[model samples]
Target: MDIQRYLQHIHFAGTPKANLHTLEQLHRCHMLAVPFENLSIIYHQGIHLTPAALFSKIVEHNRGGFCYELNRIFALLLQQIGFQVSFISGEIRARDGTFGPPFDHMALVVTLDQPYLVDVGFGDAFLTPLKIITSEQQPQASGTFHLEHDGDYYSLERRNGDRCSHAKTLYRFTLQPRQPEEFNGMCHYHCTSPQSHFTQKLVCSRPTENGRITLSESKLIITQDRQRKESTLHSHEERLAVLRHYFNIELNVQAA
Candidate 1:
């Protein structure tokens, strides 16, 4: 992979190092720059898990992807920058209070001074890495997060409010290192399955300096400092224009 090209793709100009500062900067840069999008699924396209294809689609074409595509390439970028990274699997917590299947999501267990959970794939997530080795509430630009260990599995949760009673489980994962290939089946499932949310709508979102902006199908929502503005696009042209304006994505609906 071309490390310099990937760095440019994320618009990251900071020094790359195997330290917290670099990790945090890279994490925030990637999250804010590359959106968490599922446009390919909307176009009935298969999501490729290969590193070469990921780099081509994300870095070359200047597009974003879901968990597998984003985390895989991000892990490689970290490794190239001399940070120890392990590809790990995460099971998303469903609304019904049940965890999804194994490898439902892809993330990284980056071994820095202490292990940290790093993910640019999960939409509407924290802007910085979370300390997975601790139970202490870690404050972030987005919200406070913490890890809860239940035997072999670790649950990563974010606080919905200032108190602990509102902790919401984002996803559950184990520290076991996994190969990128292990997620192939579930990745395919996410893109094609009728039950999958990615297949249900067109979504592209990214974090802003104050809050975030998300576009789902024709609805556009922009939030800044807890205040939000919502709008709807009545035409395809308007929707595409919103994508280009906010996420820097130019989509040819027919070509996608």
Candidate 2:
């Protein structure tokens, strides 16, 4: 893996020491730089999970990807920078209090002083890495997050007081280390299955200093300082402009 290129892609200038501070800085930078997008599925372009292909698409072409592409390649980059990283599978919790299949999402566990759950793929979730313990609410720019342990599994929850009466469950995961090849079946399923949300939408989102900007299909939503401004694009050209202006992606899908 090209460590220097990956660091340059994330626009990180901090030290690469395998410590808490470096991990926090790198995690935050990656979140702000690359986006969480699934435009490949929308365009009918098959996504590749290999490190080389992901590096070329993200770093060279300045595009973002879903969890399978984002977290897997991120693990490679972190490993190159001397951080002990492991790829873990997460099952996303639906709104009806049910969980998706295993390997529905991809996350990382970096072993520093303690284990940290690092993810740049879960769109508008935690900006920095979350500690792998069930104690202490992890504060983020978005909101306070918590992890609840249930026997052998861990549930990731976000506090949603105003929008909902209870804490919202984001996903459930386990500490079991996984190989990249293990996710290939679900990765293909996500892109090909009609029930998969990725195959159903064109979403490109990234976090800003104050909030986040998401371009889903023709709608452009910008949330800054707790205020949201929504707009609709009337033409493909406008959508392409938004992709280049906001997310820094230049793709051939404008004509699709």
Candidate 3:
């Protein structure tokens, strides 16, 4: 990996190599810098899975992407900076709530001094990687997350209140190395499937000084703890203006 490009993409500074400090730094940097976006997926371009291609599109082009693009790029940067990293795909349970096959989402299962579930692109996910061993409720800006291990698989559960909602058996991964190309089929499916959420909604999310700002379709939702607010966009101007006003994303992406 090109250190310069990695640094430039994530805007990492003060250190070049990966350390617990730098990892924490990079983790925060990634959370701030790169948005979890899927515009390219909606724009009719095939999602690129290779690290080289991922870097070219993200770092070189200044584009944001979905989980596959965001996490894949982050994984490479970690490796380039000398962190022990590995790739694994995640499966997203359907809204109707059924565990699909593993080709649902792409994620990473990282092993360091201890195991961690590191992902920067899940959008409003765990602020820091969840300690794989910690079953206690880990607090995040988004919500609370806890991991439960069952046999050989793990489930990531996210909750906002007493009610346990939005639980995704995120992914089941082993300590095995994965090539970027291995995610191509799933990536394509995510980008192309009409049943897929990405194909139906124009969504982008980022962390803000207060809480989080999420643009779904045309509605803007802002939440800081129990205080949640929303606005209904009536026109393109409203949508474009709202995106810039909050999330800092430009919808008018130029074509190649």
- Cα error of candidate 1 at position 42, Å: 0.3
Q: How many collisions between residues are there in candidate 2?
A: 0
Runs of candidate 3 with Cα error greater than 4 angstroms are 8-11, 161-176, 253-256
RMSD of 2: 1.6
Taking the tens digit of each residue's C-alpha lDDT, what string does model 1 give over 163-199?
6468899999999999888999999899889999888
What alpha-carbon RMSD in Å does predicted model 1 have with respect to the real structure?
A: 1.5
Task: Determine which window of 10 residues in candidate 1 has minimal summed lDDT.
Answer: 247-256
Query: Distance (Å) between predicted and true CA of 79, model 3?
Result: 0.5
User: What overall lDDT, based on C-alpha atoms, would model 3 receive against the true structure?
Assistant: 0.72
**lDDT value, candidate 1, whole model:** 0.89
Alpha carbon deviation, residue 182, candidate 1 (Å): 0.5
Candidate 2, run of 10 with poorest lDDT: 159-168
For model 3, what is the error of residue 62's alpha carbon versus the real structure, in angstroms, after optimal superposition? 3.3
- Write one digit per residue (lDDT tens) for candidate 2, span 55-169: 9889898889999998988888788778999989999998788999999999999998889999988998998899988868776778878899998899998884443446888
Worst 10 residues of 3 by lDDT: 167-176
- lDDT for every model? 0.89, 0.88, 0.72
Ranking by TM-score: 2, 1, 3
Q: What is the lDDT of residue 21 in candidate 3?
A: 66
